[model samples]
Target: MDAPSNVVRLPTAAPRKPNNHRFKEQRAAGYEAKQASVFRERYINPRVRAVMGDAETIMGIEQTPALLIASALFALADPDTQQKAMEQLAPGAVVGRKAHIQAIATMRRLRATTIGEQYDFYNAIDELEKRRS
Candidate 1:
């Protein structure tokens, strides 16, 4: 075992710990942005444009409502937020009733699983009617 005179042993470096936090956050943010873009392209923009219809109408109407609806749709994609929205809007206040109707319609159109079984469309309509009185 003494025939290794010409061989040199190299020292091994210590294993480096993975710093995944920054990369993970960056990746998550990127993925979220991409998903949001896709959602806008596929659903939000089309609906908003449909409501706008033409240049004159688009210029006449405020963009805030469409933006709010899109934001609500994004938030409603989360189950917890969807539940909170349902609870918050169930009391039939005028504004809440309108939001409830919009949310239900958006959920149905999107085929969102988050609020699939939870929202009652008829009850929402009744609440809206009550609020209108």
Candidate 2:
């Protein structure tokens, strides 16, 4: 019987890190798609459209949820801008009585979630779903 040789081999060079900038960019695109999904699910009905507008217009800055949310995030960092955006949202009502009140709140929460946070969140969600199944 022949004895087997015991040898340890180590790599001369480290493996290159997989560049995920493209993946991150894709995730950002997914975020945009989520915005569309929100509109489709929340503001889709014809009656809602009557108050909101068509899909494109309602999702537009002039009359879209994004504008309201974006404005709120901007306002969070800048009180003056927030006041202006609030005034624009509810010209007749009080300073904080805009239809975007919820949107602004959501934006505030979203500010804490950057692209990496979102990636983690999605992974967590997927794991939970798998466990549930």
**TM-score (all chains, Cα) for each model:** 0.25, 0.22
In the range 1-133, model 2's lDDT, one tens digit per residue, is 4335675344764456567676888899988888878465443333323323222222332546876676556746655655565456554343544445544433333444467545544444444445458
Cα lDDT tens digits for candidate 1, 1-133: 5539887655664356556686788899988888878465434233233332222222333448875687567665676766666566556644545545554444333445335233443334434445458
- For model 1, state the Cα shift of residue 37 in Å: 48
Once fitted onto the true fold, the runs of candidate 2 whose alpha carbons sit more than 4 angstroms away are 1-109
Per-model CA lDDT versus the true structure? 0.50, 0.49
Runs off by more than 4 Å, candidate 1 = 1-77, 93-96, 111-133
> What's the lDDT of the predicted structure labeled candidate 2?
0.49
